[model samples]
Target chain A: MDSFVLPSFISPNSEDIKRRIYARIRSDLHRIEAEIDRNINSSIPLISVVARHIMGSGGKRLRPLLMILSSRLCGYTGDRDVSLSVVFEFIHAASLLHDDVVDHAEFRRNQPAANTIWGNPGVVLVGDFLYSKSFLMTVGYNNIRILEVLSSATTKMAEGEVLQMVHSDNLEVDEEEYLEVITRKTAVLISAACQVGAIFGGASPEEEEALRAYGHHLGIAFQLVDDTLDYTGDVKELGKPVGNDIREGKATLPLIYTIKKAKPSVKKRLGEIFCAEEILPENFLEVREMVMRSGGIEYTLHSAIEHVQKAKESLDIFPAHPTKETLVEIADYVLCRRV
Target chain B: MDSFVLPSFISPNSEDIKRRIYARIRSDLHRIEAEIDRNINSSIPLISVVARHIMGSGGKRLRPLLMILSSRLCGYTGDRDVSLSVVFEFIHAASLLHDDVVDHAEFRRNQPAANTIWGNPGVVLVGDFLYSKSFLMTVGYNNIRILEVLSSATTKMAEGEVLQMVHSDNLEVDEEEYLEVITRKTAVLISAACQVGAIFGGASPEEEEALRAYGHHLGIAFQLVDDTLDYTGDVKELGKPVGNDIREGKATLPLIYTIKKAKPSVKKRLGEIFCAEEILPENFLEVREMVMRSGGIEYTLHSAIEHVQKAKESLDIFPAHPTKETLVEIADYVLCRRV
Candidate 1:
């Protein structure tokens, strides 16, 4: 949460880092996604169906953007970096697929989940397809170290998913464990995108480390803010239901804080409601008010802001450049955005 | 079924080849599975769990033997071929995990299916762990061609699963589609192991093609014979129930063939039976007799034998090397194996 809101409060002068490098990065990310699209299994009509469903849904394409922007910030000047950027996005998409399966989610970004429409097996297979394609894409670079970084990231993501699974329906899940899950399942890719970009851009070890930390912090901030929004933000703007975390039995920060502060009877009532796969709107509303009255939601938002701040602080080592400014702007947007 | 069975039955000296390769391949398979046990997931406990589940299960490692023996027959002996021989088995095992989830299978090789024991998500993630480990091993060879071969094979296997899912509970699945599904889902890796072995062993293009044909034909034959056995084999030997395919509504060779020859009512009975997830022993026996009476089982076996013959004929290009002799023995053994 330290990383989530820190960037916005810190402030940046640049609007969008409008440079040739930025344009090139955008072009490169596009190419990488196109290449990955080529490699995904052409057989599963369901895959194509769901992919079209999601890709055409006008996503922010944030991960690919981060990878390309970070690469450019480090002065990466090759077409290969573009290919690597695509790999990063594919990794993110793969995680999202598995996450929905784990979450048994019915929706994503205000739209239907692939699994909800196609069933779990199709979602699982398409996720597998994306994973295989990403691994194959890594084969093109011939960089063993890079492969290790990405493979290890993926392995960690799966582990994080398992960890989260163990925590499911357990209201006692702490902030430390939740943080760890997001770090592996989310932040690793962001960190890896930056690290790979720096490596490809010819950054030194220290610079690479700095950028990796920045991306990792950004990813943590991003997810924390996302979690916060699920409880406090407007559903119309967030493009999903409000207070969704409780529905999944996920011990999101707001709920955890509410549990910690609630009366014994209230806590017991909350537990019974949150532990189920389904939650009625009436119980959901009651829980929302309890969390708010207990100061849980505000506390979560503050923590999210802190995460954004940490994200900004990580960029202190990087020199003042437009790329750096844009990175800072992304962090600010992450925490402050109503959506 | 032809290629799978005839090699074992009609090979002039089939027994000799099986005898020589059996012990050696078994040792090598253990070594490779040892690597799988050692290097599965970085999450140590999960790796141990996978080891416990997979290595703990008692079963024959026949695929690796085919790879090693087939490669040796192609007039080349190298360590990578054998290492990759293990990779083939690992792929098979990993696919088994996902297959169980899709099939909702309970028993495998006389033990609980991983999904049934550890649950679906555990089986899925561990399957993924093995897959990533396999890719890592492939990349270690720095053999791009081999990586491509195995990668493409893996993709096909996933696709085949989806195809099977789409076709599930549908008795209308034809031999052509079933052939496509199994060839990709099961046979491709078997064929890939042989193809990769030939390539790694420095077989010429023609020889490589011949060996590839050997693997392809043999793989299809093997699946067909196994399907036949699913209808006819003894429970004590086969581990799982006989006619498990029909129970799962999978129109394997015998049922697929027999459906064609059955009276309209008989065919209708099959359609109903094929819609089930499990069938009682009484129904299984009734279907078996009905299939045999319709000559469905016999025709499928005949086709299987034709495949085995073609697989053997492909080996004519390899001359009469000892490895070639073992390959012949393997062909014969594959035809007769019960479990």
Candidate 2:
């Protein structure tokens, strides 16, 4: 969620959070690799090649880092969170790898997508491998709550994918429908990351609910910003192909928002171009221009800010803690950052 | 793995094992549907439609029943063996549903395939849904060892699929390589079912190993019979087109064996037909006849008997109990029984 990246005032605090998480995640990443080799009977090198390449591709580590920081905010002292957080990261990574294959995406984070290098079969199976391994790690906790939360998130993620498949290119998609898909596809896991932290920390039910709501709102803010950025993003800065989501025919938030406010005649043209068999690069620019002029981008951004506000306000229920402040700060960063 | 089917056997003891295992499995089948529904969280109607169709298809429940019986032989008393065994079946069923989509298969177990009824996307997503659900159920156990065993089996199964994909139409596939694919594709989970049972019963490592061997051999034998039945099996018994695998150019054991033993010219003809886009239906029958005449089917049956014998031997290490007897009987059943 680019919205979580704040400027000068929050930079140091965010850096502090990242610094603490970075250290644990590094070893946790290694441990995950070690376990991959130790437990999986496949040839070690293939797994290592795909794994290291992706792990080394250098993600923002946003999800795993959030999971760890969430656990810290909840005062988690257990060692399981590190492994569990890594599981969160691996599941995230695995899904991306498979998504690239399914979407035939050529790049991720400006690096060659793993599927591009490994081929679709390896990518698909390896993604399945990581999923199985993630479950293997989580089973150590034996908490039905833990399993239930993560499992439900995964199911929702798949449903979201299916929903996207059904809705993609159907240019009449409204913001509500787009929000539902992205919430399940992108936000649920982020939400689960925080909720699981509260779970593993043995937080009170009220606190857990607050944490879940916080993560859910924060993730919504992050994804809304992502949808906005896709319209007016710098591919170099975002590390993804500009207009990639639209090319895939997904009617993401900004476009949907714009369509909502547009005159019916203008909306019809936008819808037609989006549903067309072929779209020129110029169409991407033209569509973005239309949305900006119509104030749709601004509206989506405002919606993101609202979510971030909700995310931060939910944090007030928790007693003061350093990590809590960082949590609140991250929420603020998501909406203001310009990735 | 049809190399492990029954000879013309006169022993009543083996027959008794069949009856007992069937009886146990029949009752457990009811719970399998319930467990599947409890875990599936899709649009309730979608889940209901798929689950109802699948369980209502009248599957033999052989694998789950075998798992339960094998666990019992190792002195397991807990009822969890049944749930775990159902987990085994769900994975099996889910794989078939997905495989039908990947292979574009039209039929399964003598009925119209789920994909044909539900369409590929619906079938594929539901398969994924079922798979993740199975993982969730396995995670519910909280036993690291069991989780590792089943998760590893799942990975093996995926790799096995890739192997099968690559080896398609490869008539030169030697017996050993053929065995490797099926072991992962078909046997590992069956083996894990028994092994995990022993583990859950707190059996010694040696005992678990022995139980795993039994299941491994039995599974190989089971699959071997399936391969044979593909050509020679009764449609009423096996369901689906018996000749489909051959028509699709699968270089299974019967074909591999006959090709190895055939006259050089016959082998050349076999090679020509395998690579062609379509083989004459008569040519398919000719190959079948040749396989039978070359003793391919007979040889496969003997191998099945040998595996079942070995499977029985794996249980001799245990003290005499009715459960042990039943397990031994199951091994015999694998070699001998029919629909």
Model 1's number of clashes is 29
**lDDT by residue for model 1 (B164-257), tens:** 8788788888899999988987789888888888877778999888888888888898898798888767787677867677766678878888
Q: What DockQ results for candidate 1?
A: 0.39
A322, model 2: CA deviation in Å? 5.9
Model 1 lDDT tens row, A263-324: 99999999888876579888878887787789776677677778777878877877888788
TM-score of chain A of each: 0.86, 0.88
Highest DockQ, which number?
Answer: 1
lDDT (Cα, tens digit) per residue for candidate 2, span A1-339: 122222243243545655554454566555545543444344535665676666666565567667777777777865666667777777787778657755778888778888788676566656666776677678677676787788778877767766776786787887788889889878898998888888888788888888899989998999988887787766677788678888989887778778878898988889878988888888887887787788777778788888998998888888888778767767866765545
Cα deviation at B52, candidate 2, in Å, is 4.4
DockQ for every model, please: 0.39, 0.30
* Predicted structure with the largest TM-score when compared to the true one: 1
